[model samples]
Target chain A: MKKNHSGVRIGEVTLKWFIALHLSLIVNSLAGVASKMAGKQKFLSFRFCICYGMVLVITFAFALAWQQVLKHMSLTFAFTNKPITIIWGLIWGVLVFHEHVTWKMILGSAVILLGIMVGVSGDSGSDGSSLPPEGGKGDV
Target chain B: MFEGLGRYIAVWIVSVFISSIAQVMLKMEANREHASKLKEYMNPMVVSAYFIFFLSTFLTMYALKYVPLTYSPIIEPMSYIFVPVIGVLLLKEKISRRRLIGMGIMIAGIVIFSM
Candidate 1:
């Protein structure tokens, strides 16, 4: 019974982390979308101010959530996950910007997705082992 | 300052570097335990990091105005490369072999996608 309970707890924790990580990614991508939208307006115009202001607010949210993610994951893994935004950007481009995706782009995105899976799977360590002690010299 | 391709590359790299610094600073901020107060948001490191990031963003926008179609592909992924290296040197983040390979594959994928 104890073993079964522990396994359930682990599953719960994994699910919680999965939700948190993806939330961060989506929010980060939204910030990019906001910034891109802001770029379309004239600088210092009221519309520009509104769009850019939204960007700032959304970016603050992204930063906060990203910090939270780093608390649970290693810097290396988190940093590597930065490329995931590219996939989001492509999706946004197609849906929002009406951009076309060529075959090369699709193949490349698939490779990137594969890479993210490999990277995330390589680490079972909960506490980012690659993250060094604060202000401590890293052995590299 | 954005006339030539070389200058554009320089500006793009500088912007990426600044962005990487911001990334590291945010990571450092994350590792700390702070109270939920206005003062916490006013932390000097966090503020400066944001300031630098804003500057980087502005420079990128400006640089793009001059060379948007030509260099956008390569320049965008430069940060993915920069952050990990900066994270290692300045932030003392270690990289395992598997993670390194993963990063390489991701980067190659991005380069291809951008192309």
Candidate 2:
């Protein structure tokens, strides 16, 4: 049972680290915005390149941050928070895309989020570290 | 504003399928033995898997041109469903009851949300 200098346990992290991880998750979600913008541009156009390039940069950054976050936080915690991205997606759609929000969409998103939470918890419960990184999922 | 919406949905589904295959490829790579730790990550399989992911992302972006950003995330979990089913068939993996229930819930949610 080796403890880090921060007195954190193997799976425990400080609140600051937790917030940092969420920020990274939000950053990852922002790539979806860029993706949508890229989709609107002509393929291989300057604006398209810029938007897709931004997506790549954000993905790389999120991947790096995810590794760092995993070191400080347990996979269980990280996986649990992953579904929060769905909420973020909804928020971005409404605020950025100006898509109308219907009660049905909200309810459906809630159910999907709950299912992922259940499914991931079951998989990680047996062996947390054995699974591959799930960064690609829910990414635009 | 929604012309040829069916084709756009098809493109999104194809992207989801590609991404799911990439996920399975990653799992396959994880289950393999490499010469060294570095080789484990930098090998052909891992590299190709990521390349496939890139293709998927491009398709997703293309689909976004026609599909709503909000709707894309709703159906995005289709890949998650595909992975487990593919795993069960190709990898001979077992599905736990809890996992089954979760999948059911997700399907229900997708139905409700998109309906």
Candidate 3:
């Protein structure tokens, strides 16, 4: 019984870590996209080139970290938790873009958040356990 | 003004959906293709070089043109959020009661978070 409970706890922790890693991906991707859209064309300015390079480097680093994380976690859990970035994006939009938040948008985000929580909570099996082998081909 | 906002939103949605499909298809293709050629695929030196070239040449260009950088990443998460909905509609997958409840709670949380 104790072993079973511990296993469940470990799974929950893994899910939370997966969510955080995905959040990093979303935030970093947004930053990269914003930089590019700001007219930081390639080879235009030395500083812009440096910034773009840095973004690429950091994104690659995060991709590596994510590959490591996936080794111990289920893809379903990881992928399901990834959608929380939509909620984060909404937050960023309000703060950065000064977009108005409508009730409908709010409701939609709530449904997504609730769905992720419940999805993670209900899973207790070893389905989707076939993780891609470690140090395999990875992407950013 | 109404039409303008609607257009923007529609374009955003369509672009994101296409990109999502692209991502999934790429992953699926890469996995299936590489499994048979594991020796070549697992060659990290080659894969890293390929990834860098692919991102800079293909993925980045399409992404920047169709979707604003700032918003694209945020919207990328929608792929996951909508997967179940897609499964239900297109694949005829069943949603259990627990999943329904979870979906409801997620909707509520998203509302609060957005505000």
Candidate 4:
């Protein structure tokens, strides 16, 4: 892969990129669901371990997918789309966890959706590089 | 001082901000070149980033004991606000007008979501 003068490669937006982003979000949200399930068990108990194990696995997938996302999109674009995970959370809550949602929560989610749409508007073929010109490198 | 929804928001904010920092670290780790591709994983910064990310995930789960799944999503946007600020301050990445606008809108959405 060839990097530009800025040492960052430009991304070409494609259907595969979109699909990967959504898949990442879905897997990321599942980590939350798994965590919630783990909360019901005693810490480090058999049940807790199983639930937490699921969290770890799902999170591993999320991290891997997120790296792919950053390769193809800017952090701003990638983070902006993260709110979609809320919808997935709500779905899991309603369908799997049987959690209740109030009307206000629905309204707030709608506004968040609007904001996500506006945030991503006209972002295609734009400055999607992940690194700056003068980069910082060190271990923390 | 924080309790109920306020506490959940606070925890979520911390988690997302830390996660964004980890994101930047991973991106930096990605930029470096190594003879052995697997050696990249051994970079201290990358390892630190993943460790920080693990802590963030733990905090998220801890907060879930108090927060419902539906409400937790509202806090996810906090990273959108945080990542750009850190990008500018730490990474010195340039921000475009459109991105600024998008971030502004996202902030507005967060405010409304918090209500």
Candidate 2 local accuracy as lDDT?
0.78
Worst-scoring 10-residue span by lDDT in model 4 chain B: B72-81
Q: List model 1 lDDT by residue over B1-115, tens digit each.
A: 6568568667766876777777677677867888777656689887887787778765654454344322333445555456667888876877767767867886787778667
For candidate 1, what is the interface RMSD? 6.9
- DockQ score for model 1, please? 0.26
Return the lDDT, model 3, position B78.
Answer: 46
Candidate 2 backbone collisions, by pair: none
Ten-residue segment with the worst summed lDDT in candidate 1 chain A? A131-140
Q: Could you tell me which residue pairs clash in candidate 1?
A: none
lDDT of 1 at A31: 51
Clashes of each: 0, 0, 19, 0
- 1 versus 2: better lDDT goes to: 2
Kindly list the per-residue Cα lDDT of model 3 for residues B1-115, writing each as its tens digit. 4275345444445544544333433343444434456654565544554454444333343344433333432244344345445545644645666666765665565455445
How would you encode candidate 3's per-residue C-alpha lDDT over A1-140 as one tens digit per residue?
A: 12353353344454346456676556444543443433335554676566555655655665676676666666655545554545655666566555566666666665665566565446443543121111111111
Interface RMSD of 4: 5.8
TM-score of each: 0.65, 0.88, 0.52, 0.74
Off by over 4 Å in 4: A1-24, A62-83, A121-140, B33-36
Which structure among the candidates has the greatest TM-score?
A: 2
The C-alpha stretches of model 2 lying farther than 4 A from their native spots are: A1-12, A125-133, A137-140, B1-3
